[model samples]
Target chain A: MNRLQNLFANKKSNLLSIYFTAGYPELNTTLDIAEALEQAGADFLEIGFPYSDPVADGPTIQQSSEKALENGMTLNVLFEQLQQLRERVNIPVLLMGYINPIVQYGIERFCKKAAEVGVDGVIVPDLPIYEYEKLYADTFKQNNLSNIFLVTPNTSEERIRKIDGLSNSFIYLLSSSSITGSTLNVSTSIEDYYKRIKGMELNNPTIIGFGISNNASYTKACEYANGAIVGSAFVKHLAMDDYLKNIPEFINNIRPRS
Target chain B: MKYGVDEHGYYGDFGGAYIPEMLYPNIEALRAQYLKVLNDDDFKAEFDQLLKDYVGRPSPLYHAKRYSEKYGANIFFKREDLNHTGSHKINNAIGQILLAERLGKKRIIAETGAGQHGVATATVCALKGLECVVYMGEIDMARQAPNVARMKMLGATVVPATSGSKTLKDATNEALRDWIGNPEDTHYIIGSAVGPYPYPEMVAKFQSIISFEAKKQLLEQTGSELPQYVLACVGGGSNAIGMFYNFLDDESVKLIAVEAAGKGVETGHSAATTSLGKEGVLHGTRTILMQTEDGQVVEPYSISAGLDYPGIGPQHAHLFKVNRAEYVSATDDEALNAGLLACQLEGIIPAIESAHALAHLEKMAFKPGDNVVICLSGRGDKDLDTYIKHFGY
Candidate 1:
């Protein structure tokens, strides 16, 4: 099993995954951030390779992506930085970005390179399931890389089932139908939506993401799923002074260590 | 061999809904209901009525005698500029508004480049008494100030997209994010023929009225339904696809699409997408886009705001790939000069976007009796400041 599968199997509840742009704040800070996240208690992490046009992201992540690209972060540069991933970071790593960069890098070549770098899975939001199944499924399978799929409140039950069938790792559950950075508002309808998904009893574990900011939101999300991921919030924290030194404080603020 | 989109929303290998799961329900709902509503008898009647009475349908197919004399061909202009909003964008806006109404959507959102589509969408929303929001690039709002004012006067909220390049592409991204946030109550009226599934096809069908009318008018005027050639300027290729829709299968008729070459195609400041672009996904559709080798979208340039887009519609990409239609480009100087020539010769001032297509007439070798039709997509009223400044008037 890959790192993602193994992590989900070992950790049953209250898992925390932190996401940050690979080359944000500075060029050579990618591995440094990853090592810090692992040391600070992130169960897994998503390393976002910046795309010029990230439609799914809000202002915080969007600005980070822009900053990352301006710092000259290309897929080749990202890969070269990730060459030390296995040596420095032990937790699961997933490369998240739009599909164009992967397509330009060549899908099979990308999967192989990602696997070689100890990357466990991928999360390309724009890569449709139809195209993935028809074209790139085999390459991902051969590379032993889990292609994570996202399910939103708006996703139909049948489509969610299909995503579940195709998924080997945890399914990403967006807190609400929104871009990243919005606060997770746990209204009656949202609670019902979460309950509805939990009732389905799918094969794969579910990890709530998008708007999982602060302790309260994270705790509420953990009640419904296996874990919750902090993306925009963590990326926002990276903008603070001496962020690398305060990684433990950030992690503790979300889920205090016993 | 077919030029039309397949049931899977593809034209050959291009075009599919490549959006994130956040947009799946909205796109899926549109995909499921667009055709059924479009073909319904009541929907058709209302759409036809709006075209006829509200927006002015069957916009004239004027025989441009002076243009014919200059180009050595029987030149005709499909005067889409005479529509209520001074552009062909109103056609699709009206059609989509009706569809949105039927789908129980109360809010309308759109993205605009030149403000023509924004004006059109705002106009339709006013007619339907629905809430309207338009995302325009910060730079575009400054350049196309009059259109921004017009949209505001029409009771639509104009939000400035302040991200990457601050142009149409950014506006589109902002609109998409808005749609993702408010998926249920809002319907995004994508201005061009570029987006995820159903949008490209739906916009093409609505704007197909251009060719549908032109063909009937051509037969009456020239005693022949088929023209020797048809030309239209392509931004996201909505108007061009519409102008080419009925003639796509007419093998004898040649089709030409013009793109904006800001300085020149080779000068690194151009929106000549098919000329300088590679195959990739942009704005949720698998199409050709100008991009860096590492696959980041490159900013495109054009003097005309409408044509300052980084990519074309998927149908245009397919047509370019298969050589079904010829794609050419005109620089800003050429298009500006052509705009002046049209005003002096034909007594019509064309939008700079349309002037790109008109400018190509100077490069073509046509027979004396060859009948040619050009889609004059919009009026130059919104571009008066640019024209004045360029000419030092």
Candidate 2:
């Protein structure tokens, strides 16, 4: 089984997944961030493969992606950086990004290379669910990579159920129908949306993401799913001058103290 | 050939909502309500009135006697340049602004290459009393300064996109980012028949009035509802798609889409999408785009900023794939000469983008009575600087 499947099987609730762009702040910082997140008690890690045009990302993540690209990040470079990651980081690691770079790298080649380097799963937000099922699902499964699908409040019940049935790990529950980094308010509408998804009793566990920044929002997100993933907020923390010292503090502030 | 978008939002094997989850609700909302709003009597009434009064539509389909003599054909020009905002762009802009109002959106965001769409969008937003922002390439803003000033004068904020060749593609990227950031209140008025689903289809529908009007006028003048061929220049292919939509099922009326070949199709500096592109997704739709082996989008070049986009609309991709539309290319020199010829022959200064369509006339073998309709998609006032520089006028 994949590390993500194993991680989900072992953990029941509040399983925090931390997302950080692979080469942001500086190049060759990939392994350090991954190892630090695992050591700091993150249940899983999503290493962003930066692309030039990230339509889904808001200002903070977009800026970091731009910097990461400027810092000479590429699929080949990222794969090389993550080669020894398994030696130091025991937690599950996923590569999250747009599909264009992966296609440019060759999808099967990317999946094969990702597996060779110990990547646990992949998250390409723009890859439609139908296209994945028709063209990429078997390739991902053959390479032992779990392809995580995202569900928003606007997703139909039928589509969400389809995604859940195919997912061997967890579904990424987008907190609201907006991009990453915006403030998430757990208003009655959001609470009601959470309850509706929770009531579905999907086979795969859920992990809420998008708009998850601090402990309050993270806690509220975990109330509806298995855990929560923080992206733009954590990316903001990484861009700081003192990120090396603050990575642990940032992780600790979002996840409960172990 | 099959016409219109399929249930999956595809045009043949192209087009779909390949957007991130954050945009799902917005796209879904649009897909669900677009047809309903378009078909609503009130919406139709308002849109029709705006096109007739504000945009001055049923723009003349004038018989070009001098041009017909030069090209050996019965040539007609669908004068989209006569529209109030000076291009066919106003048609889509008016439709989208009305839709945004119906959707309760208070702000409008758009992207522009030559700035025609930006000016039109700003005009509508001003008319509707909505906040407007337009993203334009820094390079395009410099070349198309008059349009930039016009947009600003009409109360639109013009954001210059400075990244990645600083052109139309980059401007579109900046606009997409802005929409992602302000998803709740901002309605992205994509100026072309590109982007994710419902947009390509929606923009085409709004622009379809071009061919619709042409068919009626053709029947009245020539006693035939269809011309022998219809030609228009393709960028993201809004005007071309709009010009071709009403003629798709009419097998007798051949469609020709002209692409900007820059210096030449083989010169490695061109916007000839069908020739240089492969199947890929860019700006949310699956279509043919110029890209490297690793799938990074290649920056395309054309003297006409409006014809410099790297990809055609997805429907055009499908039409090209099925051979329903003949995809041809015209180089910068050829288009410049055609623009000049039109000036001398018809006393009309065609936009350099539209001159691509006019350039295709040089290659065709037309009988004396063969009727041809070319969509004059825009005016040349914005391209006056380019013309002056190129010809040393």
TM-score of each: 0.99, 0.92
Error of 1 at B208 (Å): 0.4
How would you encode candidate 2's per-residue C-alpha lDDT over B4-105 as one tens digit per residue?
899889998999888886677778888999899999999999999999999998999999999988888889999999999899999999999999999999
Among all candidates shown, the one with the greatest lDDT = 1
Residue B274, candidate 2: C-alpha displacement in angstroms: 1.7
Clashing pairs in 1: none
Cα lDDT of model 1 by residue, A90-136, tens digit: 99999999999998998988999999999999999998898899889
Q: What is candidate 2's CAPRI-style docking category based on DockQ?
A: medium
Clashes of 2: 1
lDDT of 1: 0.95
